[model samples]
Target chain A: MEKIKSIIEVKNLNKSFGSNHVLRDFSMEVVPGESLVILGKSGSGKSVLIKCIINLIVPDSGEIYVLGQNIRELDQDQMDKLRAEVGFLFQSNALYDSMTVRQNLEFPLRRHWTKEMRDLNAQSAVKEALEDVGLGHTIDMMPAELSGGMRKRIALARTLILKPKVILYDEPTTGLDPITAREISELMLQVQEKYKASSIIISHDMNCIRMTSDRVIMLIDGRNYISDTYENLQNVPDPKVREFFD
Target chain B: MIHLIKIDSEFLREVGEIARFTGRFFSEVIKPKQEWEEFINQCFWIGFKTLTLVGITAFIMGLVMTIQSRPTLLEFGAVSMLPAMVSVSLVREIAPVITALICAGKIGSGIGAELGSMRVTEQIDAMEVSGTNPFKYLVVSRVLASTLMVPLLSSLAIAISLYGGYLGVNIRGNVSWHLYWLQSFGALGYGDFIPSLIKTFFFGFAIGIVGCYKGYNSKKGTEGVGRSATSAVIVASLVVFIIDLIAVQVTDLLGLT
Candidate 1:
């Protein structure tokens, strides 16, 4: 296997809420154009880790280098610029309930471009994003009208609209049916291949771990146990690793 | 004693929450993107939807005030003072306060419930994770809508109230419609109109910010959404009266009357 350039590097990341230590000196890295899956139980700082990398929540003491830039140290405007290059899919698809699917896709695009700059040209981009996610026919439907799987697909369309360099998935398959989950995992691969972007997925689903990851990182008790290939992870003899799979 | 202490602590916590929520309004107001579309939507919801209710109430209010005051004026042989008194009371004190109270019941609860459900269902978290600024989109837009729209609604309500007052005068006797308006405006100077109008903006701001705050910070489930909606309406109503009282005292101290 060829080693690619590191697009993200984290060192000594620490975060806490009041007395609960969420992420304690956590650290890891993702190579450019590689797919990495983070495996952890709920409340183990998986979501916080993703948020900190994007500077949504500032870490207490740490360094997060995304695309070779220290994301933690950047100012708000600078951070916003950096954030535009990264896409995030939330556990619960956060489509605006009040808006139609088309409006949801257009929201991020219109926000990124001013009204005068956003004309007929951007409309095609929104349509293309909708088509990419297999949601072209559901453009006028509200999120409440869609099933869970369909909503997730629309959210993916919105995320891809920005053409992000890195895609972060937070529990992408948590509540989906097995078939839907499989399709989502497959779509993740498709997105990776199409965009040629680095991808990070946080999940407890072993099926998702096995299917979507090129490298697996186990997070147990606020620490990284191992970062290796899926086959290597399954063959390991660590009690914690065994327990996770069991 | 312990129970009393617990109650006090709970009250303080609620008060602190409301104050913190209101404080955030100032902070978010200075931020960018304005969320103009969302603001217009909120105006449509808060001002346009509630217009009929506010109008009816104001109209009845004017009718009742005029009718009640006419008899009292007649008893004192000062029947001409009816228009002046009703207009002064409505424009200066009654209209803004009543309109705000009604809005606190309607718009405040709506905002609180909407945002609270959104919070509980993880919609807000989704916005943040998606690299969208929820504060700018949700808080600023709603606040701007309330601040701008409430005044317009209040003006419409006052106008309706005056029409109702005209009807009240015509019921028992004849008063020229033109003279009735003249007398109404005769009593209202810029002193009454400007201060009263100025304070409605704050009233609107308070209602909007408090509703958004309560809903935005709602707890993890369905019950929390209800609590947020209830608290928002209660706190917003209290804020309206508090602002009205302060406005009255300040205006009196300034000798504007």
Candidate 2:
């Protein structure tokens, strides 16, 4: 039997801001179609780790390979081309406040899709993505008009419109109430099942972690302290790991 | 002494950052794949939106100048030169500077606040992650729009101001509309009009660039947005005056004064 290859590979990544180091010689990988969670407290560098993978924050030193290409070696145009294959859902949703829902969904298509492609299929694509997120009726509303949960769903819809091979989620349920949080978690599962897209979710919400994670990586003190299933992590005797389950 | 040195260095660092930001604008502006749609949108907002404020201020300026200058000219027995005096002053100096100052308050603060809020919300980061060049789309379009629009606004202000001067003359004297316009145009030469018009482009560029630079670099969230907007107006207004002073000197050197 052939072994499965990793979709994303980070090796000895290090990052620092002035005298404060955030990620230190940390490394991880995401296999195809896996939902891998980076679990840590706020300010524990989980967000920094994922941002480094997408090249949003340049690592001070190390290598990041996405889809088998070394990101540091790519030029701006090349990086942009690579970015089309990766979707990032920001914590704040980052929806363009100036645009309506349809326009917001179409914003990414403006650059990645050709005029002919858009003229032929853009409307259907927008509708399909919105339907996937259960937000088909919000096609004309402004982002400010949507409830918090709906805004998150619209943001996820925008991410799905590209049909990316990988999705990087930065705290998908941080501000939502528990009910809405679970809904978003279930939505994450549906996306994975429907699209078969691998994801790196940076989150600490145990409910979200347990529901969405195939495996969890414990990010502690700027390093990957352990990697295991959420159930396995719950049993780990290490006090550092036990603190979370306790 | 150490505290003074630190302050000086901090000031120098800010100047260097702004210079670097201005240089990046030139590099991105000349690149292909210009954002013409956003540019047109910005022109509509930066130009058309501020027309009322600039027009009203210019009319008042011309009317007040004409009315005030009457007594002085009467004492010199040169009250008949009112139209020429008012038109020359409006076309050569008052209209452009006042219009630019107004824009520095309105357009400059507006751009700063909008971009600063966007930055705080991570909308800029989202644009970059979507494979779009945010600088090219946002900064270049706004800067170019302001640079083009300020001169157009100033030209409009000059015309409206001359009309106000005509009205003022009619109030206290009997100069006909035709004769008033004739005297106004007769007093102006290429030197006065061209130099004044040329200076407004620099004024616009300064306002746009300063606003963009502050907003793009704003941090610490909402409070930082307020600071960016306030500083954009303050710095752009000062730069407008500085540019005006330099334009006058250059015009004098060219024997156009």
Best by DockQ: 2
* Cα lDDT tens digits for candidate 2, A1-246: 454488899999999989888898999999999999999989999888888888889999999999888999999999998888899999999999999999999999999999999999899999999999999999999999999999999999999898999999999999999999999999999999999999999998999999999999999999989999999999899999998888
Positional deviation of B60 in candidate 2, in angstroms? 1.5
Candidate 1 residue lDDT tens string, B113-152: 9999888877787666555678888888888898887888
What TM-score is obtained by chain A of candidate 1?
0.95
True contacts kept of each: 0.38, 0.70
Tens digits of lDDT, candidate 1, A1-246: 544367888898898899988887888999889899999888999988997887767889989998878986677667767777888888877778888988888777655676766685577878888888787889899998999999999988888988999998989999999999999888888889998989889999998889989999888888887889989888899888888877
Runs of candidate 1 exceeding 4 Å displacement = A1-4, A114-117, B1-33, B68-80, B125-132
